[model samples]
Target: MYSPEFRREAVAALKTSTLAEVAANTGASPSSLRRWVGRSDLADRPRSGRPPIQDTADQVVEALVATAGARISGKDYSTRALAEATGLSQSIVSRSVRGLTVPLTDVGGGRELSLVAAGFPLLILGARTEDAGGEDGGGGPAVPPRRIQRRIAGIAAALRSAGVGRWAQRFDSEHRQVPTDNLLELIAAGGSDRFLVFDPLGEVPVEVVAESDSRVEVHRDFAEFLEALKDLLAGCQDIPGSLLDLLSARVRNGLEGVLWRDSVGVDASRSSMSSDSMEISSWLPKETRSITEHLAIALREEIIDSAYEPGDRINPRLLSRRMRVPRASVDAALRRMVDDKLLDGSRGGARIPLITTGDVLDLYAARMAIGEVVLRSLSLRPQRYLVPVQLALRQVEASAPTRSGIDVEDADLHYQQELARASGLRESARVFEAVTLRLRLFISVLQLDYSPASDRIVSDDRAMFAALSRGDAKTAIEVWRGKVDNAVRHMAGLLGRRRFDQELWTQLTRSLA
Candidate 1:
C-alpha cells in the first residue's frame, strides 16, 4: 500500500499546500509534470469519475459584467452595484453567484455560454495498407494518401453535442471530401494545435481548442481545486455535480439522438434529419441577456472538456482567451462561483472543474470495477489485444517524433472510456465527464509540472484484453486490479489518502458484480 505520507510530503513542499500552488512552487518543467502524472506506476492509466460541477459555482456577477464576445452593455450589477440589481444586499456582482446551484437561473440569459467560437477541429488521418500495394510492396499507405477532400462533419457535430467543444464551422460544418495528403495543411489552417488526438490506426476526427500564451495564464490553484473537489466528494459540500451533468447529458443525449438517428423518421423534414445527423433541438442557440453568466458557463464546460485522459488536456485559460475575455474576469467569476459552491473541481489535474465531485468518484470506482469484471468476463479475447498492444509498443518505439504542444492522455483511458461505452454500462457518457473532471483538476494543480503517460493503463488494459482473449478471467482480474491499484497510488500522492476511500469502490463493485 502507498503511504498517505507521500501526499503529505508533496503537500508540505507547497506554498499553500494546494496542488496548483505547490506545483507552481516546485518549478518542475511541464514535461516532467506530464510524466509524473502518469508514472504513478510508470505507465499511463486513465483517471476517472471525479466530483460534479454543481459542487461549486463561478460567481463574477454575470449581469454586472458582460462576457467578452457576446458584448453586453447593461445597467446591471457590477462589483459595486449588486445590492440594487436583485434587491440583494451585496455590493459586488462578482461576489453574487456563490453557493447557488441555479446561478444562471437567478441571473438570466446574460450568464450563459454560446455554442460557437470555442474550438478548432483536429481530425486523425489514415491510409489502408492494401491501398498502397500488394504483399511484395509492404508499406502502409503514404503518411497521407491522395483522396478527395472530406472533413468529419458528423464527428464534429457529435463532439460538440457531447459538449467537448464548439465545432469550428469554417472547416467542419460540412463534410468535404478532403484528400489524405492535405491532412497537415488542414490541421494548420482550421485544426487547433490544442487537442486530444486519438488515432488508433484509423480515420478518426478529433480536435482540441488551444490556449494562448501559457505563461500569462492564471487559474484556480490546482491543489486547492483538487482538495476542494475531494472534500465535496467526501460529503463536505451541499451542491450536486449531477446538476451540471443535467445540462451536458441533456444536450449530448439530444445530440446523440440526432447523431444516431434515434429520433427521426426516414423522410423527416429537410431541415430536421434523424437524431443521428441534425435532429438536435437542444443544439439550438439560446438568448443571452447577460454575457458574463453565459461566458462563465461556457468556460466551465470548456474546463471540463480539457480533461487529461491521455492526449486531450487543456487549460481553462485557453478557453477564456478563445472566448475573447480577460483572464482576470474569468478567474474572478470562477472564484466567486467556487466560493459559493456551484462547480466542484476535485480531479486535481486540469483547470476545468468537474461539476459532480463525490458521485464522480463513485462513478469512477464503479466503472473501473465494472471494467475489471468485463475484463474477467472477456477472458477469451487475448488475440484481439495483440495488434493494439503491438501497435502501442511500436508507438512508444517511435518516441513521438516531436512532442505535441498538448500532451496525450493515456491510451488506456481512450480504450476504457470506449469499452465502458461498448459494455452498455448506463454511465458511459457520464463517466466521460467524470474522467475529464479529474484531468481538469489535476491539470489546474500541476500545469507545466504535469506529465501524464499511460504505460500502466496500457499494461493493464492490454493484459486484461489478452487475458480475455485467452479465456483467463483470473488473469483479467489481476491485471485490472493492478491498474486500479496503481491509479490509487498515484492519486494518493497528489490528493490525501483521506480524500479517497473503499466505500465508493466497494459500492461500485458490488453493483457491477
Candidate 2:
C-alpha cells in the first residue's frame, strides 16, 4: 500500500495533472491509484483480529522429543508424563510428537527413546550470557534480565523522543521473545500496526527477526534490532516521527550538508546542485561570513569529524570546484588551517597531520594537563559552560559510532571541540583543539599499521560528558586523561617505542599548565 504522504501527493498531483501522470510519478498501478483516490485516508491501522498466542504445545513437544532423544543415562519421558510437564492435553502431546532428524529407538511401548547410531549434524545452542548472581553464576537464558531491561529503556527513550511514547508504554518488554513460526502466523493474520520481538531459544549466534507486511528483517544482535526498530517507527505514519526525528536536532540540522558532500565525492564539480542538496544547503546556518571563513569552517568540521583521514591530500583544485568557490579562497582557508596547526603543509600540499610515538606522548601529556585546567575552569562557571557541553553531548548521542568509519571519531572530536570552545580558558581551548586534531589524525595514520578500538574513544567521551554534567571536574579530567593515555599507549606500542622524550614531554605539559 502507498504511504499517506504518497497518496496525498498523488491526490494533489491529480488536481493539476492527469491520473496517468500521477500513476507514472508515483509508480503506482492505475487500479491502486483509483483506490487511493477513493479512500478518504491512507493511514495504516491494525487489522481486526484476536491477539496472537504461541503454539506452546508444539514447542513443548519439540523440546521433550529433543531432550528424550539425548538418552541421558537411559532416562526418557512418556507422552502422558510429557503432557503433564508441558501443561498440554495428552492427546495434543501425542499428536505433537514427531520423528526427529536424529533417529531414536522407541523402546518403551514405542515411547522410550534411544539416540541414532549414525553420524548426523546435531544443532547445539551453547551460547551463554553474562553470569547471573547465583552460586554457579547460572542464568536461565543467555539474554540477562538487566540487559533486556536496558534495551527496553533505550527503546522507550527512542520512542518517547520520536513522539510515540504513548504507544511505547503498551509494549511489555519483559515478555519479549524471538518470533517463531506460530507467532509469525498470528502476526501476519493480524496484519498492519503490529510489532513483535522474538529470540529463538538455545540458538548459538542468535538472531532477532522482525516481520511486517510480508517482509522480514533479521538482525544479528540487540543493537542492530534497535536500529531496525528505529527505522520502522520513523517510516510509519502511525508513529508521528520522521527519519530526522530519530536523530538529535543538531545532527539532523547539520547532517544533510555533510552527507551530500560525502556522496558527491570528487565528482561534485561535474554535478549541478540537486533539489535535495539545495534543500540541505538552505538548512545550513545562514551566516554572513566571507567565502574564506566558510571554507575554513567547513574544512575544520570535516577535519574534526575525521572525514579527512591522515595522509589524505587536500587537493586545492578539487576542493575549489567541489565547493563552487575560488581557488584563492580555498587556498586562503588551507593556509589559515595550516597556520592553526590543524593541517600539515610540510611536504608539498595541505594534508591531514601525521604523528610519531614522540608526538603521541607529548600530545597526551598536553591534553591531560589542558583537560585538568579546562575542567577546573568549567567547575568555576558550570552554568556558563555546561549547557553547550550538554548540547554537544546530544549531537554525539544522536550519531551511530558503530555504523561508519568516521562518524564515531568525528562525533567524539566534535563534542570535545565544543567543550573546549566553551571553556573559560581561551588559549587552553585553542591549544586543546589543535592537539586533539593532531592526535586523531595520528590515530588514523596508526590505523594503517594496526587496528585501534574506536569504541574506546566514544566511551571515554561519554564518561567525560557524564562527569562534566555533574560538575565533577576531577572525575571528568581523570576520564579525559585516561582517554589520552590509552591512545598514547597504543600508538607507542605500534611504533615499538616505550617512551617519548622526557624533556619535550615536560615542556608540552608545562605549556598546558
Instruction: Give all TM-scores, in the order shown.
Output: 0.30, 0.39
TM-score of predicted model 1?
Answer: 0.30
Q: All candidates' lDDT scores?
A: 0.34, 0.47
Candidate 2: residue 338 lDDT (0-100):
83
Evaluated against the true structure, the overall lDDT of model 1 is 0.34
For model 2, the superposed segments whose C-alpha errors exceed 4 Å read 1-314, 341-354, 440-455, 492-513
Instruction: Please give, for residues 1-513, the per-residue lDDT of candidate 2 as tens digits.
Output: 557787778787888989889888879888877887788877776758763223556555554443221111111245577678878788776555422111122111101000000000010011112223432122221111222222222223322233321222333332233223433343334323233232223221223222244333433344444444543322211110111122222121211111112212211221122233332222122464455445544454333222244566675643553467777788888887788676788886688776666767766887788778887777667575677777667655655434443445555666776777677788998788657656655655554222145556657778887777777888888787677666566667765545545566556655543
Q: Give the worst 10-residue stretch by lDDT in candidate 2.
A: 112-121
RMSD of 1: 27.4
Task: Give residue 300's lDDT in candidate 1 (0 to 100).
Answer: 32
Cα lDDT tens digits for candidate 1, 264-303: 1222221111123211111112452133444433433333
